[model samples]
Target: MNEKQFDKIKNGKGFIAALDQSGGSTPKALAAYGVQEDAYANEDEMFNLVHDMRTRIITSPAFDSKYILGAILFEQTMDREIEGMYTADYLAEKKEIVPFLKVDKGLAEEANGVQLMKPITNLDELLKRANERHIFGTKMRSVIKEPNEEGIRAIVDQQFEVGKQIIAAGLIPIIEPEVDINSSGKKECEQLLKKEILKHLDQLQDTENVMLKLTIPTEANVYKELIDHPRVVRVVALSGGYSTVIANEKLKENEGLIASFSRALSQDLNANQTDEEFNDTLEKAVQSIYEASI
Candidate 1:
């Protein structure tokens, strides 16, 4: 990634508001919002629900303007016009919040008992779209479901390879190697993922800067070493499935690491709330995550 572009996102309050939920994720969110069971029956319906959720989120006072530096958006909603303006355009125009796209097609079939993201096809074309939309970066996911070093290595290899391509197209890449927090041997998986990440990162040219979005490791300050690496623009932690309270607690101990949380950020929000309650709820979530970043 270009250091200049990376700097804008890495500095300040380095919190990413991840609103890029896929079809599978939408149903769960709808259930939490107490949407009727019929709402989850069709893909189109799911997108509509997700779109409405995005409307509430983007319009909320806490989003795109508070301690957030950027947002990672689902493809369908990235340039989507809400009211009379595009979501990305609205954020940039009003809040100075950067926008990023989620590019990978989701997980592939498990390899050696671990899951990796499917490569993005026509990625150059997608980057062209992102550039056109004024999005500054991209995020893709791969999960370490098991503690196999070889498997994690494969995942990181693919991430770095795709990441280089993203940089070539002038967008920053947030390489996510998420470890399943509830799985057996979580700490071991974290160690394996970290080691494999270093393998790809150490081999990159000095001019290429990459950002990491890893699951929170069991040990606090475990990622400080990565932050010190010159090639790494910033090291960010995902909340995974942790409650906001627990996520914030773990995040506070890790100096130099910021949050890129999705669920934890929205866990308390619901369509049932009044505007005042919704804004207050979102503000508290933002404040907690923001304080952890500092």
Candidate 2:
């Protein structure tokens, strides 16, 4: 990325909204928000929705010109040839939009008296998929851990290894060490999480243009402390597992540039309006965060 590009992202005040329209049934609430029911039925509909959403966000005045729109591609969306072609076509058509590829197989779980995460056990497969995504004008965004030391190490290692491959392939990697709100408590937990995250960053010898996804600390003081870290290039606040309204309010109250919001936006979709309405609401929500940041 060039200096101009870096500044645009660093100074921009908005969140990167994610719609997991990959496989699971589209929520009824989201269907009511104008999302096509068929969109979630197959990969074709999902890809179209991705393109439609991107175009809508970029063209909207609510989202700043410098802000970036990211789409999350899941396992179901990337499994077939037709869906991949659609994704590539959409990405090629919109070269400027930042596309993110989700790498984790699934959520982490506890087993055998040890916290375990579904790791990207196949490095070659991951590389191949990432290369395909690159061909479609999208970069890779991998989530490393949920909220544990072991999980964090696994994520950092994967990021370090994948970062090398992605850079060699001429792509950007969005490194995320997501802290689970379920395991998080007050200020002390936030501090420990920040410390662990920073430790991981320190271990990345050649890491470049890395982004951190963290739950917005419940305490403003902790949030400020974490944001002030010198090693943290960009901070994208997580929307927590809550409503977009609440997430938007938190983003508004917090001081951060990029917000990674997924579940809230997807859960709000209603089928009453057209695709345009769904996109409009998303843009509005993002703009609310941008304005709040300013």
Candidate 3:
């Protein structure tokens, strides 16, 4: 990763807006906004709704580097033209929001007590395109339904393995090992997850350059070591299913973790608002999340 590009984001607003919902999640999001299931009955309609939402986000007068340093975008949204401007370029040049690409192929069938993200077979091509487009970074994710030792270990190993490739490809990778909030033994699992992450970081001689996006642990500030690690550039938290208000409360307590929220950031936004109402609503959401980062 280019140090200048990385510093531009890390030293500014301490949060990243996760707008990288896959095709499967987009319709549900649209439905939640009262677009109705029928309105996005097919792929094209669903994509159109997402495009409009993304455009509104970038064009909002409230959009600035102060509230959001970066945004993680799905492949379609990354390539789509935002009012004839390349979506990523418009965000970087016009709004100062660094664009990060989502490279994981969602989840694969469960194995060894966990769900793993499918490998990106076209990663080299994807990275080339990202570099060509001047995008800043990349993100990939895996889910932990339960904290089985074997499962968590496999996940940590896989993330760092891919993370190394992303770094060599000239983009930072936000490796996410999202633990389910409702899982039993969540607290114990959190500690185990932390240990495994450290184990992996130790293996990487150049980890000080790595980035992490983990679920908020049951205990506050439990990731102090990882956050303070010389190899880790930034540590961010995922809201998972929490509401924005609750997510902010948890985020405020963690010294190293900044918000990289998806649903919590967009859940309260309805499609019925006027442009002024929408921007005001967005400003409040962005500001609350940004304050927690501070």
Candidate 4:
């Protein structure tokens, strides 16, 4: 682990930028960026287009370490290049931003009101490559749709189980158990999630630590205990379908949770915009999230 990067994540005054949209999410992300379905003929071409999109965002002046502490990258992005350097290398060495890789293979079909992560085949190989490419950590996600204790317990158990593997491979894991905001019992879901998470956290050894990326709870500061947990490095909040403005408002209401936003962060950017316009829009988004984080 990189001590400097760890310090930055633990004490930095900025938010993480979630640019880690994968194969399943690339189309929607591109559509929002003004690229249509007809823009690419095949999956490879589609990935190329999305890579170019990510490249633009990474190279933009507004997307640096000033208001951004870290960036989460898709596996492909970590493998690709940006301005003649590998993407993760560029982010860490030149841009001074910590780089994280999204390591999950998407989610499984919902069962018991939760969607657990699909099995990650050859995870050790992926983690080795991420470390070789200068990545600082890894993020994996599972989703909760309701407050089923059995389902939530399973999700957290799966996360910590995989997290231990990541730790063995010398990377911090950001375990995300997202609660669907539109669910009928959102608050109950968060409450159950918190309980499950604390139970798992208690089992970790002194040398082991992990980050938590949670949905912004329906009740502000409900995660205060998690934020102060000795085993937790930092607690971040995902945008989770909320608009940027609303996400920011709720984020400010929570004292310590910081933002790790994807759609909300890039919603204002369109491929049709000129360089000046794109940068201006990104500046505003970064500034708002940064202010809310601090």
Name the weakest run of 10 consecutive residues (lDDT summed) in model 3: 202-211
The residue ranges of model 4 lying beyond 4 angstroms of the native Cα positions read none
Per-residue lDDT value at 155 in model 1: 89
Candidate ordering by TM-score (highest first): 4, 3, 1, 2
* Over 4 Å off, model 2: 1-7, 21-69, 75-95, 111-116, 135-170, 184-186, 221-231, 275-280
Residue 262 lDDT in model 1? 90
Question: For this target, which candidate reaches the highest lDDT against the unseen true structure?
Answer: 4
- What is the per-residue lDDT of model 1 for residues 1-294, given as tens digits with 9 covering 90 to 100? 334445667676658888888766777877776676685677877788888888888877777455888888998887587777777787777767778888889899888647888768879888999888878888999888888878988888889999999888878898998888887888888877777777787888876778899888898877778888878877888999999999999998888889989999999888788889888998999998998878
RMSD of each: 1.9, 5.2, 1.5, 0.6
> What TM-scores do the predictions have?
0.94, 0.68, 0.96, 0.99
Task: Arrange candidates by lDDT, descending.
Answer: 4, 3, 1, 2
Question: How many steric clashes between backbone atoms does each model show?
Answer: 0, 11, 2, 0
**How many clashing pairs does model 2 include?**
11
User: Per-residue lDDT of 257-288 in model 4, one digit per residue for the tens?
Assistant: 99999998999999999999999999999999
lDDT (Cα) of model 4: 0.94
lDDT of 2 by residue, 1-294 (tens): 334435544555445555444333334323544665655776566555654543443344443444444445544444433323544334334434344566555545543212333555764576576566543212233332234445455555655565555545544555554545565333444565566656666665564445566666666535565466654456776666757777667666676545777666445444454567766775666556555445
- Give Cα distance to truth, residue 215, candidate 4, Å: 0.5
Q: Write the per-residue lDDT of candidate 3 for residues 1-294, one digit (tens) a residue.
A: 556667866666558989898887888878766687777667887898888887887788877787788899988887788878888999888887889989999888887667888888999999898888778888999988876899889988889888889888878888898888888878877898899999888877754367789888889999999989877878889998999999999899888689999888888778898988888988898999999988
In terms of TM-score, how similar is model 2 to the real structure?
0.68
Q: At residue 75, what lDDT does model 4 achieve?
A: 95
Error of 2 at 14 (Å): 2.8
